[model samples]
Target chain A: MSPFVLDDRLERDSEFVTALGLCQLRLLKDSRWPWLMLVPQRAGKTEIFELTPLDQAMLTFEANLVAGALKQVTGAKKINVGALGNIVSQLHVHVVARHEGDPNWPGPIWGFGTAVPYDNDRKHAFLTALNEAIGS
Target chain B: MSPFVLDDRLERDSEFVTALGLCQLRLLKDSRWPWLMLVPQRAGKTEIFELTPLDQAMLTFEANLVAGALKQVTGAKKINVGALGNIVSQLHVHVVARHEGDPNWPGPIWGFGTAVPYDNDRKHAFLTALNEAIGS
Candidate 1:
């Protein structure tokens, strides 16, 4: 098997937070929503079914863990989870915290608008809180 | 605990196909995409994290199974799986088969345009093929 490598698009768009059992927990840089991505640290696999059964279970567990933490930390009205590799086919799972009347309320967050990155202080504070919440 | 009831919007938009270990498999009525929904039979849960650990694992397994089956049946280039309850607020997971240059290429299929329902013969044939693929 080839060595695992993070997709270039995902690396450019997100900040790595911590490593879970089977995934690298990364926070998407877009400040518009509290979004975190779980990318399994497996190479050349573009779908969940491609993972071993154990890794698949681990991914689900870690995704749930992160989603619950994100909701509690952000107090989002809903948490959206998706794995759409249409644009960047790197097998990453997105867990986004949504509010009732946010900019793109009642719709998927992808391709809604240009992403506004978090400023320095805001990024540090958000990452700190998320790490504390996830106990990573 | 309240008895499990299918969400009104989900019922209105999908046809009941079969029941998996922890979910009710449903076929979205739209003909444009080969879409399937796995709704856990637990009542009043709007998120996967709300389900017990066992059910969460089961949901992951069933999602992978259905996604693989959908890909085989449709010969799609990619499979998108999501659990976004912004409008429906129901604990259901969507497994959609996507292809290159589809109407909503490289973007989410949600709220892109009005759904085009399948005709009677087409719907029957699709359901039959999907059922055979899933062995249900």
Candidate 2:
């Protein structure tokens, strides 16, 4: 099998945080929401079913672990998880930490507005805490 | 433990299709997109991580099954899966079959536009075919 390649759009918009059992964890650049994405290291796969059963199970576990970690680190009221490949056609799961009155409250944050890239200090601190939270 | 109760908003917006091993499958009323929701029959749970490990694994299996069935029945170019309990904290997973150049191409369907309820005949036909595709 060919080595997995991150989608250009995802690469441009997010920073690598760590690697999970079956996915490469990345923190989205947007500062408006506490968001992390899990991209399974599988080439040419665009949907969850495209993964083998073992990989699928691992994806679930990793997603759960990341979501819980995100919630814990951010103290978010809710965590929104999604795998939408319409624009990028590469399988990546988004785990966003949402508060009651975040920028896009009670709504999915996929296409809300211009992404406010995180400043360097905030990004560093966020990634450090997240790494500690996920133990990665 | 209390019996599972469908959230009022979800109940108003979707029709019961069938019960999978771990979720109550329902078809969204919107005709714009072929959307199905898999709501785990576990009351008061608003997140996948809140579920037991076994239930979480079952959710992954059922979601894959429904997404595949929806894709087969709709011939959708892509299938988007999400579990966002922002508005209705019912812990339901959305399995939407998306096609290229559809109404909201490259954008999420959530909170995009008002839903157009499926007419009686079309709804019946869709439910029949979906049931057959899911082998329920």
lDDT of 2 by residue, B43-103 (tens): 8899999999999999999999889889988899999999998999889999999999987
Q: lDDT per residue, candidate 2, A64-130, as tens digits?
A: 9999989999999999999998989889999999999898788789888999988899889988888
lDDT of all predictions, in order shown?
A: 0.92, 0.92
Interface RMSD of each: 0.5, 0.6
Q: After TM-score superposition, what is the CA distance of residue B82 in candidate 2 from its true location, in Å?
A: 0.7
Model 1 lDDT per residue over A1-136, tens place: 8999998999999988999988999988899998899999999988899899999999999999999999988999999999999989889999999998897888899989999978989888888998898898
> What C-alpha lDDT, on a 0 to 100 scale, does residue B19 get in candidate 1?
88
Docking class of 2: high
What's the true lDDT of residue A19 in model 1? 91
Model 2 gets an lDDT of: 0.92
| Model 1 Cα shift for residue B39 (angstroms) | 0.6
